[model samples]
Target: MFALEIENLSFTYPDLTPALEDVSLQIKRKKKTAILGANGSGKTTLIYHLNGIIPAQQGRVKVLGQQVDKKNMQEVRKAVGLLFDNPDNQLFSTTVFNDIAFGPRNLKLDPDTMTRRVQEALERVGIRELAERPPYCLSLGQKKRAAIAGLLAMKPRVLAFDEPFSGLDPEVADQFREILDELVEEGATLVFSTHDVNLAYGWADEVVIMKAGRVLTAGTYDLLRDGQVLKEAALPLPLLAQLFRNSHEQPRTVEEAAALVEPGSGRLKAVDSSR
Candidate 1:
Protein backbone atom coordinates (compact mmCIF):
# COMPACT_ATOMS: atom_id res chain seq x y z
CA MET A 1 0.00 0.00 0.00
CA PHE A 2 1.15 3.55 -0.61
CA ALA A 3 2.21 5.50 2.42
CA LEU A 4 1.27 8.77 0.77
CA GLU A 5 -0.76 9.67 -2.31
CA ILE A 6 -0.99 13.24 -3.58
CA GLU A 7 -3.22 13.88 -6.54
CA ASN A 8 -3.25 17.10 -8.56
CA LEU A 9 -1.90 18.95 -5.53
CA SER A 10 -1.46 22.68 -5.93
CA PHE A 11 -0.64 25.43 -3.47
CA THR A 12 0.01 29.14 -3.55
CA TYR A 13 1.18 31.55 -0.90
CA PRO A 14 -1.12 34.12 0.69
CA ASP A 15 0.34 36.67 -1.71
CA LEU A 16 -0.63 34.40 -4.66
CA THR A 17 2.81 33.06 -5.52
CA PRO A 18 2.48 29.44 -6.59
CA ALA A 19 4.49 26.91 -4.64
CA LEU A 20 3.24 23.66 -6.08
CA GLU A 21 1.32 23.17 -9.29
CA ASP A 22 -0.61 20.07 -10.15
CA VAL A 23 1.91 17.84 -8.45
CA SER A 24 1.01 14.16 -8.22
CA LEU A 25 2.98 11.31 -6.69
CA GLN A 26 2.76 8.10 -4.66
CA ILE A 27 5.25 7.00 -2.05
CA LYS A 28 5.38 3.27 -1.36
CA ARG A 29 5.45 1.91 2.17
CA LYS A 30 8.76 0.92 3.81
CA LYS A 31 10.86 2.43 1.05
CA LYS A 32 13.41 5.24 0.90
CA THR A 33 12.27 8.12 -1.32
CA ALA A 34 14.31 11.22 -2.04
CA ILE A 35 12.98 14.59 -3.14
CA LEU A 36 15.63 16.62 -4.94
CA GLY A 37 15.38 20.24 -5.93
CA ALA A 38 16.97 23.61 -5.63
CA ASN A 39 15.75 26.09 -3.01
CA GLY A 40 12.22 27.49 -3.48
CA SER A 41 11.25 24.43 -5.50
CA GLY A 42 8.36 23.45 -3.16
CA LYS A 43 10.01 20.47 -1.49
CA THR A 44 9.32 21.82 1.99
CA THR A 45 5.89 23.04 1.02
CA LEU A 46 4.98 19.59 -0.26
CA ILE A 47 6.02 17.93 3.01
CA TYR A 48 4.07 20.42 5.15
CA HIS A 49 0.92 19.39 3.31
CA LEU A 50 1.61 15.73 4.05
CA ASN A 51 1.12 16.29 7.80
CA GLY A 52 -1.50 19.00 7.34
CA ILE A 53 0.92 21.59 8.69
CA ILE A 54 -0.42 23.77 5.93
CA PRO A 55 -3.82 23.19 4.40
CA ALA A 56 -3.76 22.23 0.75
CA GLN A 57 -5.01 24.99 -1.53
CA GLN A 58 -6.28 22.37 -4.02
CA GLY A 59 -6.32 18.65 -4.73
CA ARG A 60 -6.24 15.69 -2.34
CA VAL A 61 -3.59 14.45 0.06
CA LYS A 62 -4.11 11.06 1.62
CA VAL A 63 -1.85 9.50 4.22
CA LEU A 64 -1.97 5.72 4.26
CA GLY A 65 -5.69 5.45 3.44
CA GLN A 66 -7.19 8.43 5.26
CA GLN A 67 -7.67 11.75 3.49
CA VAL A 68 -6.14 14.63 5.45
CA ASP A 69 -8.67 17.15 6.67
CA LYS A 70 -9.31 19.28 9.75
CA LYS A 71 -11.02 16.45 11.63
CA ASN A 72 -8.28 13.93 10.90
CA MET A 73 -5.33 16.33 11.42
CA GLN A 74 -4.43 14.87 14.79
CA GLU A 75 -4.40 11.29 13.49
CA VAL A 76 -2.43 12.32 10.40
CA ARG A 77 0.21 14.13 12.44
CA LYS A 78 0.60 11.11 14.69
CA ALA A 79 1.16 8.88 11.68
CA VAL A 80 3.63 11.19 9.90
CA GLY A 81 6.65 12.69 11.63
CA LEU A 82 8.37 15.60 9.87
CA LEU A 83 11.87 16.73 10.79
CA PHE A 84 12.53 20.28 9.83
CA ASP A 85 15.67 21.43 8.05
CA ASN A 86 16.72 23.34 11.11
CA PRO A 87 16.98 21.55 14.45
CA ASP A 88 16.59 24.80 16.34
CA ASN A 89 13.19 25.28 14.72
CA GLN A 90 11.96 21.93 16.04
CA LEU A 91 13.55 21.82 19.51
CA PHE A 92 11.82 24.21 21.90
CA SER A 93 11.87 22.60 25.34
CA THR A 94 14.85 23.34 27.56
CA THR A 95 15.81 19.78 28.37
CA VAL A 96 16.36 17.02 25.88
CA PHE A 97 14.03 14.69 27.83
CA ASN A 98 11.19 17.20 27.77
CA ASP A 99 11.62 17.90 24.07
CA ILE A 100 11.55 14.22 23.19
CA ALA A 101 8.58 13.66 25.51
CA PHE A 102 6.49 16.49 24.06
CA GLY A 103 4.66 14.51 21.39
CA PRO A 104 3.70 11.52 23.54
CA ARG A 105 2.76 13.86 26.37
CA ASN A 106 0.22 15.50 24.06
CA LEU A 107 -1.29 12.09 23.38
CA LYS A 108 -1.80 11.75 27.15
CA LEU A 109 0.01 8.49 27.35
CA ASP A 110 0.33 7.05 30.85
CA PRO A 111 3.34 8.35 32.75
CA ASP A 112 5.17 5.00 32.58
CA THR A 113 4.47 4.59 28.88
CA MET A 114 5.46 8.18 28.13
CA THR A 115 8.72 7.77 30.00
CA ARG A 116 9.46 4.49 28.23
CA ARG A 117 8.76 6.05 24.84
CA VAL A 118 10.98 9.04 25.52
CA GLN A 119 13.84 6.86 26.71
CA GLU A 120 13.57 4.53 23.76
CA ALA A 121 13.55 7.43 21.36
CA LEU A 122 16.64 8.88 22.93
CA GLU A 123 18.39 5.52 22.82
CA ARG A 124 17.40 4.97 19.23
CA VAL A 125 18.92 8.29 18.21
CA GLY A 126 22.06 7.64 20.29
CA ILE A 127 21.31 10.61 22.51
CA ARG A 128 20.47 8.80 25.77
CA GLU A 129 23.45 10.41 27.52
CA LEU A 130 22.20 13.88 26.65
CA ALA A 131 18.73 13.44 28.08
CA GLU A 132 19.42 15.74 30.98
CA ARG A 133 21.27 18.39 28.99
CA PRO A 134 19.68 21.59 27.79
CA PRO A 135 19.15 21.76 24.03
CA TYR A 136 20.96 25.09 23.76
CA CYS A 137 24.10 23.57 25.26
CA LEU A 138 24.25 20.66 22.82
CA SER A 139 26.29 20.76 19.63
CA LEU A 140 24.52 21.24 16.29
CA GLY A 141 24.75 17.51 15.55
CA GLN A 142 23.48 16.64 19.00
CA LYS A 143 20.59 19.08 18.70
CA LYS A 144 19.65 17.39 15.39
CA ARG A 145 19.66 14.03 17.13
CA ALA A 146 17.47 15.32 19.95
CA ALA A 147 15.03 16.73 17.44
CA ILE A 148 14.91 13.35 15.69
CA ALA A 149 14.37 11.69 19.06
CA GLY A 150 11.36 13.91 19.60
CA LEU A 151 9.81 12.58 16.38
CA LEU A 152 10.71 8.98 17.09
CA ALA A 153 9.00 9.23 20.48
CA MET A 154 5.77 9.58 18.56
CA LYS A 155 6.45 6.24 16.80
CA PRO A 156 5.19 7.61 13.50
CA ARG A 157 4.85 5.13 10.63
CA VAL A 158 6.17 7.59 8.05
CA LEU A 159 9.23 9.75 8.73
CA ALA A 160 10.03 12.73 6.54
CA PHE A 161 13.09 14.92 6.77
CA ASP A 162 13.97 18.20 5.07
CA GLU A 163 17.63 18.58 4.14
CA PRO A 164 18.56 16.15 6.90
CA PHE A 165 22.21 15.77 5.93
CA SER A 166 22.88 19.45 5.55
CA GLY A 167 25.52 20.83 7.90
CA LEU A 168 26.38 17.34 9.15
CA ASP A 169 29.97 16.12 9.10
CA PRO A 170 30.81 12.96 7.16
CA GLU A 171 30.78 10.68 10.20
CA VAL A 172 27.50 12.08 11.54
CA ALA A 173 25.97 11.96 8.06
CA ASP A 174 26.94 8.29 7.73
CA GLN A 175 25.42 7.61 11.15
CA PHE A 176 22.18 9.22 10.08
CA ARG A 177 22.26 7.17 6.85
CA GLU A 178 22.58 3.99 8.89
CA ILE A 179 19.70 5.08 11.12
CA LEU A 180 17.56 5.63 8.04
CA ASP A 181 18.49 2.21 6.68
CA GLU A 182 17.53 0.63 9.98
CA LEU A 183 14.21 2.45 9.99
CA VAL A 184 13.45 1.12 6.49
CA GLU A 185 14.53 -2.38 7.53
CA GLU A 186 12.05 -2.18 10.41
CA GLY A 187 9.25 -1.34 7.91
CA ALA A 188 9.00 2.44 8.32
CA THR A 189 8.40 4.64 5.31
CA LEU A 190 11.21 7.16 4.80
CA VAL A 191 11.15 10.29 2.64
CA PHE A 192 13.76 13.01 2.66
CA SER A 193 14.55 16.15 0.65
CA THR A 194 18.08 17.01 -0.30
CA HIS A 195 20.11 19.03 -2.79
CA ASP A 196 22.96 16.53 -2.77
CA VAL A 197 22.70 14.71 -6.09
CA ASN A 198 25.44 12.17 -5.33
CA LEU A 199 23.90 11.28 -2.01
CA ALA A 200 20.46 10.89 -3.54
CA TYR A 201 21.83 8.85 -6.44
CA GLY A 202 23.52 6.33 -4.13
CA TRP A 203 20.92 6.12 -1.38
CA ALA A 204 17.41 6.57 -2.68
CA ASP A 205 15.30 3.69 -4.01
CA GLU A 206 13.08 6.23 -5.77
CA VAL A 207 13.87 9.86 -6.62
CA VAL A 208 11.59 12.81 -7.31
CA ILE A 209 13.14 15.80 -9.05
CA MET A 210 11.41 19.16 -8.89
CA LYS A 211 11.82 22.54 -10.45
CA ALA A 212 9.70 25.71 -10.44
CA GLY A 213 7.14 24.08 -8.15
CA ARG A 214 6.56 21.11 -10.44
CA VAL A 215 7.84 17.56 -10.65
CA LEU A 216 10.32 17.26 -13.50
CA THR A 217 10.60 13.51 -13.10
CA ALA A 218 10.30 10.70 -10.56
CA GLY A 219 11.86 7.27 -10.79
CA THR A 220 14.84 5.17 -9.69
CA TYR A 221 18.48 6.39 -9.61
CA ASP A 222 18.64 5.72 -13.33
CA LEU A 223 16.84 9.00 -13.79
CA LEU A 224 20.09 10.68 -12.79
CA ARG A 225 21.64 9.23 -15.90
CA ASP A 226 19.41 11.38 -18.09
CA GLY A 227 21.39 14.50 -18.85
CA GLN A 228 18.36 16.35 -20.19
CA VAL A 229 16.30 15.68 -17.06
CA LEU A 230 19.22 16.66 -14.82
CA LYS A 231 19.69 19.82 -16.84
CA GLU A 232 16.04 20.71 -16.64
CA ALA A 233 16.03 20.19 -12.88
CA ALA A 234 19.12 22.46 -12.60
CA LEU A 235 21.06 19.53 -11.20
CA PRO A 236 24.27 18.10 -12.59
CA LEU A 237 24.74 14.47 -13.44
CA PRO A 238 26.16 12.43 -10.58
CA LEU A 239 29.94 12.14 -11.05
CA LEU A 240 30.02 8.37 -11.32
CA ALA A 241 27.09 8.32 -13.72
CA GLN A 242 28.71 10.93 -15.95
CA LEU A 243 32.05 9.11 -16.01
CA PHE A 244 30.52 5.77 -16.94
CA ARG A 245 27.69 6.98 -19.21
CA ASN A 246 29.58 6.66 -22.49
CA SER A 247 30.79 3.15 -21.68
CA HIS A 248 27.22 1.72 -21.79
CA GLU A 249 27.77 0.92 -18.11
CA GLN A 250 26.16 3.41 -15.74
CA PRO A 251 27.41 2.78 -12.24
CA ARG A 252 25.30 4.35 -9.51
CA THR A 253 27.65 3.80 -6.57
CA VAL A 254 31.32 4.45 -5.94
CA GLU A 255 32.10 0.76 -5.56
CA GLU A 256 30.57 0.03 -8.93
CA ALA A 257 32.60 2.81 -10.51
CA ALA A 258 35.76 1.49 -8.83
CA ALA A 259 35.14 -1.91 -10.38
CA LEU A 260 35.11 -0.18 -13.76
CA VAL A 261 38.42 1.67 -13.40
CA GLU A 262 41.93 0.90 -12.10
CA PRO A 263 44.62 3.52 -11.54
CA GLY A 264 47.41 1.77 -13.48
CA SER A 265 45.09 0.42 -16.16
CA GLY A 266 43.84 2.34 -19.21
CA ARG A 267 40.72 4.48 -18.59
CA LEU A 268 38.41 2.19 -20.56
CA LYS A 269 40.30 -1.04 -19.83
CA ALA A 270 37.51 -2.47 -17.64
CA VAL A 271 34.83 -1.55 -20.21
CA ASP A 272 34.16 -4.02 -22.99
CA SER A 273 34.38 -2.11 -26.28
CA SER A 274 32.20 -4.67 -28.12
CA ARG A 275 28.51 -4.03 -27.45
Candidate 2:
Protein backbone atom coordinates (compact mmCIF):
# COMPACT_ATOMS: atom_id res chain seq x y z
CA MET A 1 0.00 0.00 0.00
CA PHE A 2 1.12 3.58 -0.56
CA ALA A 3 2.44 5.41 2.47
CA LEU A 4 -0.04 8.22 2.03
CA GLU A 5 -3.27 8.23 0.01
CA ILE A 6 -6.07 10.65 -0.80
CA GLU A 7 -9.24 9.49 -2.47
CA ASN A 8 -11.65 12.02 -3.95
CA LEU A 9 -10.89 14.34 -1.08
CA SER A 10 -12.61 17.73 -1.18
CA PHE A 11 -12.71 20.62 1.25
CA THR A 12 -14.56 23.95 1.46
CA TYR A 13 -14.35 26.70 4.02
CA PRO A 14 -17.55 27.82 5.76
CA ASP A 15 -17.75 31.06 3.80
CA LEU A 16 -14.88 30.88 1.32
CA THR A 17 -15.05 28.91 -1.91
CA PRO A 18 -13.88 25.31 -2.18
CA ALA A 19 -10.20 24.88 -1.38
CA LEU A 20 -9.91 21.38 -2.81
CA GLU A 21 -12.27 19.49 -5.10
CA ASP A 22 -12.32 15.73 -5.52
CA VAL A 23 -8.52 15.48 -5.50
CA SER A 24 -6.96 12.03 -5.31
CA LEU A 25 -3.33 10.92 -5.22
CA GLN A 26 -0.84 8.58 -3.56
CA ILE A 27 2.69 8.97 -2.25
CA LYS A 28 5.07 6.06 -2.12
CA ARG A 29 7.02 5.44 1.07
CA LYS A 30 10.27 7.40 1.28
CA LYS A 31 9.79 9.04 -2.10
CA LYS A 32 10.26 12.76 -2.42
CA THR A 33 7.07 14.23 -3.90
CA ALA A 34 6.67 17.81 -5.01
CA ILE A 35 3.25 19.47 -5.31
CA LEU A 36 3.46 22.17 -7.97
CA GLY A 37 0.96 24.79 -9.14
CA ALA A 38 0.11 28.44 -9.26
CA ASN A 39 -0.78 30.31 -6.07
CA GLY A 40 -4.20 29.62 -4.46
CA SER A 41 -4.23 26.24 -6.21
CA GLY A 42 -5.03 24.30 -2.99
CA LYS A 43 -1.59 22.76 -2.61
CA THR A 44 -1.48 23.75 1.04
CA THR A 45 -5.05 22.54 1.51
CA LEU A 46 -4.13 19.07 0.26
CA ILE A 47 -1.17 18.76 2.64
CA TYR A 48 -3.38 19.82 5.52
CA HIS A 49 -5.69 16.91 4.71
CA LEU A 50 -2.80 14.47 4.97
CA ASN A 51 -2.21 15.59 8.56
CA GLY A 52 -5.92 15.67 9.49
CA ILE A 53 -5.80 19.41 10.12
CA ILE A 54 -8.47 19.89 7.48
CA PRO A 55 -10.79 16.93 7.71
CA ALA A 56 -12.17 15.70 4.43
CA GLN A 57 -15.90 16.23 4.26
CA GLN A 58 -16.41 14.45 0.94
CA GLY A 59 -13.80 11.72 0.54
CA ARG A 60 -11.20 9.66 2.36
CA VAL A 61 -7.61 10.42 3.26
CA LYS A 62 -5.19 7.83 4.58
CA VAL A 63 -1.70 7.63 5.96
CA LEU A 64 0.15 4.34 6.32
CA GLY A 65 -2.99 2.28 5.74
CA GLN A 66 -4.97 4.13 8.42
CA GLN A 67 -7.75 6.55 7.50
CA VAL A 68 -7.46 10.09 8.86
CA ASP A 69 -10.25 10.82 11.31
CA LYS A 70 -10.78 12.25 14.76
CA LYS A 71 -10.39 8.84 16.37
CA ASN A 72 -6.96 8.30 14.78
CA MET A 73 -5.74 11.88 14.97
CA GLN A 74 -3.19 11.09 17.65
CA GLU A 75 -1.58 8.40 15.51
CA VAL A 76 -1.79 10.59 12.43
CA ARG A 77 -0.15 13.50 14.20
CA LYS A 78 2.74 11.31 15.23
CA ALA A 79 3.10 10.04 11.68
CA VAL A 80 3.04 13.38 9.89
CA GLY A 81 5.01 16.50 10.70
CA LEU A 82 3.62 19.61 9.07
CA LEU A 83 5.74 22.69 8.40
CA PHE A 84 3.56 25.67 7.72
CA ASP A 85 4.42 28.11 4.93
CA ASN A 86 5.06 30.80 7.48
CA PRO A 87 7.67 29.90 10.09
CA ASP A 88 5.93 32.18 12.60
CA ASN A 89 2.92 29.90 12.53
CA GLN A 90 5.03 26.89 13.48
CA LEU A 91 7.50 28.36 15.93
CA PHE A 92 6.04 29.08 19.38
CA SER A 93 8.43 29.23 22.28
CA THR A 94 10.54 31.72 24.18
CA THR A 95 13.70 30.24 22.67
CA VAL A 96 14.72 28.11 19.71
CA PHE A 97 15.60 25.12 21.91
CA ASN A 98 12.19 25.09 23.56
CA ASP A 99 10.46 25.30 20.22
CA ILE A 100 12.38 22.33 18.90
CA ALA A 101 11.77 20.36 22.05
CA PHE A 102 8.03 20.98 22.08
CA GLY A 103 7.08 18.06 19.87
CA PRO A 104 9.03 15.46 21.83
CA ARG A 105 7.63 16.95 25.01
CA ASN A 106 4.09 16.41 23.79
CA LEU A 107 5.00 12.81 22.94
CA LYS A 108 6.02 12.42 26.60
CA LEU A 109 9.57 11.45 25.90
CA ASP A 110 11.89 11.62 28.89
CA PRO A 111 13.91 14.76 29.43
CA ASP A 112 17.13 13.05 28.39
CA THR A 113 15.65 11.66 25.16
CA MET A 114 13.99 14.97 24.34
CA THR A 115 17.27 16.81 24.78
CA ARG A 116 19.03 14.38 22.47
CA ARG A 117 16.29 14.65 19.86
CA VAL A 118 16.37 18.43 19.98
CA GLN A 119 20.13 18.52 19.54
CA GLU A 120 20.02 16.05 16.66
CA ALA A 121 17.24 17.95 14.97
CA LEU A 122 18.99 21.28 15.26
CA GLU A 123 22.20 19.77 13.93
CA ARG A 124 20.33 18.19 11.05
CA VAL A 125 19.11 21.60 9.91
CA GLY A 126 22.54 23.16 10.62
CA ILE A 127 20.98 25.46 13.19
CA ARG A 128 22.71 24.07 16.26
CA GLU A 129 24.50 27.35 16.77
CA LEU A 130 21.24 29.20 17.19
CA ALA A 131 19.83 26.95 19.91
CA GLU A 132 19.26 29.69 22.48
CA ARG A 133 18.23 32.55 20.22
CA PRO A 134 14.73 33.95 20.43
CA PRO A 135 12.45 32.93 17.56
CA TYR A 136 11.83 36.59 16.70
CA CYS A 137 15.53 37.40 16.84
CA LEU A 138 16.72 35.02 14.18
CA SER A 139 16.87 35.77 10.47
CA LEU A 140 14.09 34.50 8.23
CA GLY A 141 16.17 31.60 6.94
CA GLN A 142 17.24 30.66 10.46
CA LYS A 143 13.64 30.66 11.60
CA LYS A 144 12.69 28.40 8.73
CA ARG A 145 15.39 25.91 9.67
CA ALA A 146 14.43 26.08 13.33
CA ALA A 147 10.80 25.47 12.50
CA ILE A 148 11.82 22.39 10.55
CA ALA A 149 13.99 21.29 13.43
CA GLY A 150 10.91 21.44 15.64
CA LEU A 151 9.12 19.00 13.37
CA LEU A 152 12.16 16.80 12.98
CA ALA A 153 12.38 16.40 16.74
CA MET A 154 9.08 14.56 16.53
CA LYS A 155 10.73 12.02 14.21
CA PRO A 156 7.67 11.68 11.97
CA ARG A 157 7.75 9.25 9.08
CA VAL A 158 6.13 11.74 6.70
CA LEU A 159 6.81 15.49 6.46
CA ALA A 160 4.59 18.00 4.68
CA PHE A 161 6.28 21.26 3.84
CA ASP A 162 4.26 24.18 2.52
CA GLU A 163 6.35 26.55 0.39
CA PRO A 164 9.61 25.72 2.14
CA PHE A 165 11.69 27.89 -0.13
CA SER A 166 9.23 30.74 -0.40
CA GLY A 167 11.51 33.62 0.50
CA LEU A 168 15.17 32.71 0.78
CA ASP A 169 18.24 33.92 -1.03
CA PRO A 170 19.88 31.52 -3.48
CA GLU A 171 22.43 30.24 -0.97
CA VAL A 172 19.88 29.61 1.76
CA ALA A 173 17.51 27.93 -0.70
CA ASP A 174 20.30 25.63 -1.78
CA GLN A 175 20.94 24.75 1.86
CA PHE A 176 17.26 24.02 2.39
CA ARG A 177 17.26 21.71 -0.60
CA GLU A 178 20.24 19.84 0.78
CA ILE A 179 18.49 19.39 4.13
CA LEU A 180 15.41 17.99 2.35
CA ASP A 181 17.51 15.64 0.27
CA GLU A 182 19.19 14.34 3.39
CA LEU A 183 15.83 13.66 5.04
CA VAL A 184 14.61 11.74 1.98
CA GLU A 185 17.82 9.79 1.87
CA GLU A 186 17.22 8.92 5.51
CA GLY A 187 13.84 7.43 4.48
CA ALA A 188 11.46 10.25 5.36
CA THR A 189 8.61 10.78 2.91
CA LEU A 190 8.61 14.43 1.83
CA VAL A 191 5.54 16.17 0.40
CA PHE A 192 6.41 19.75 -0.34
CA SER A 193 4.47 22.40 -2.29
CA THR A 194 6.00 25.10 -4.38
CA HIS A 195 5.37 27.09 -7.58
CA ASP A 196 9.06 27.20 -8.44
CA VAL A 197 9.16 24.72 -11.32
CA ASN A 198 12.92 24.93 -11.58
CA LEU A 199 13.42 23.62 -8.05
CA ALA A 200 10.57 21.15 -8.49
CA TYR A 201 12.21 19.52 -11.51
CA GLY A 202 15.60 19.10 -9.91
CA TRP A 203 14.40 18.15 -6.44
CA ALA A 204 11.30 15.99 -6.77
CA ASP A 205 11.18 12.35 -7.77
CA GLU A 206 7.55 12.83 -8.84
CA VAL A 207 5.42 15.89 -9.52
CA VAL A 208 1.72 16.37 -8.80
CA ILE A 209 0.26 19.46 -10.40
CA MET A 210 -2.81 21.09 -8.87
CA LYS A 211 -5.14 23.66 -10.35
CA ALA A 212 -8.55 25.02 -9.47
CA GLY A 213 -8.58 22.86 -6.33
CA ARG A 214 -8.00 19.62 -8.25
CA VAL A 215 -5.13 17.59 -9.57
CA LEU A 216 -4.41 18.50 -13.19
CA THR A 217 -1.53 16.05 -13.64
CA ALA A 218 0.61 13.51 -11.80
CA GLY A 219 3.74 11.83 -13.15
CA THR A 220 7.47 11.39 -13.13
CA TYR A 221 9.77 14.15 -14.35
CA ASP A 222 9.89 12.84 -17.93
CA LEU A 223 6.13 12.36 -18.03
CA LEU A 224 5.58 15.92 -16.85
CA ARG A 225 8.05 17.13 -19.49
CA ASP A 226 6.37 15.19 -22.35
CA GLY A 227 2.92 16.46 -21.47
CA GLN A 228 1.91 20.12 -21.60
CA VAL A 229 0.38 19.95 -18.13
CA LEU A 230 2.39 22.98 -17.06
CA LYS A 231 0.70 25.16 -19.64
CA GLU A 232 -2.68 23.71 -18.78
CA ALA A 233 -2.07 24.46 -15.11
CA ALA A 234 -0.93 27.99 -15.99
CA LEU A 235 2.57 27.14 -14.77
CA PRO A 236 5.88 27.54 -16.48
CA LEU A 237 7.95 24.54 -17.49
CA PRO A 238 11.41 24.17 -16.04
CA LEU A 239 13.76 26.58 -17.77
CA LEU A 240 15.75 23.85 -19.50
CA ALA A 241 12.57 22.12 -20.56
CA GLN A 242 11.23 25.41 -21.91
CA LEU A 243 14.42 25.89 -23.93
CA PHE A 244 14.36 22.34 -25.32
CA ARG A 245 10.64 22.19 -26.04
CA ASN A 246 9.71 20.44 -29.31
CA SER A 247 13.37 19.65 -29.89
CA HIS A 248 14.36 16.22 -31.13
CA GLU A 249 16.45 15.58 -28.02
CA GLN A 250 15.48 16.38 -24.45
CA PRO A 251 18.12 17.65 -22.09
CA ARG A 252 17.78 16.96 -18.38
CA THR A 253 20.16 19.69 -17.24
CA VAL A 254 20.91 23.22 -18.30
CA GLU A 255 24.50 22.40 -19.28
CA GLU A 256 23.26 19.49 -21.39
CA ALA A 257 20.69 21.74 -23.00
CA ALA A 258 23.37 24.29 -23.80
CA ALA A 259 25.37 21.57 -25.49
CA LEU A 260 22.33 20.40 -27.45
CA VAL A 261 21.40 23.93 -28.62
CA GLU A 262 24.81 25.28 -29.53
CA PRO A 263 25.80 24.86 -33.22
CA GLY A 264 28.07 22.14 -34.70
CA SER A 265 31.64 22.44 -33.37
CA GLY A 266 30.42 24.74 -30.63
CA ARG A 267 27.97 22.07 -29.40
CA LEU A 268 30.78 19.49 -29.29
CA LYS A 269 32.97 22.04 -27.49
CA ALA A 270 30.25 22.76 -24.98
CA VAL A 271 29.76 19.04 -24.28
CA ASP A 272 33.49 18.64 -23.77
CA SER A 273 33.61 21.63 -21.46
CA SER A 274 30.70 20.24 -19.40
CA ARG A 275 32.42 16.86 -19.27
| Top-lDDT candidate index | 1
TM-score, every prediction: 0.95, 0.92
CA lDDT for candidate 2: 0.87
For candidate 1, lDDT tens digit of each residue in 1-275? 79999999999999999999999999989999999998899999998888999888899999998999999999999999999989999989979999999999999999999999999999898989999999998988999999999999999999989889999998999999998899889999999999889999889999999998999989887798889998988889888877776687767777778776767764755565566
- Tens digit of lDDT per residue, candidate 2, span 1-275? 78899999989989968899999999888888899989999998898888999888999999999999999999999999998999999888999999998889998999999999999999999998899999998989999999999999988999999999999998999899888888889989999999988887766888899999999888876655744778889887787666556555666656666666547555433233322
For residue 268, model 2's alpha carbon misses the true position, in angstroms, by 6.0
Going through the candidates in the order shown, the clash numbers are 0, 0
Model 1 residue 85 CA deviation in Å: 0.6
The positional error of residue 238 in candidate 1, measured at the CA in angstroms, is 0.7
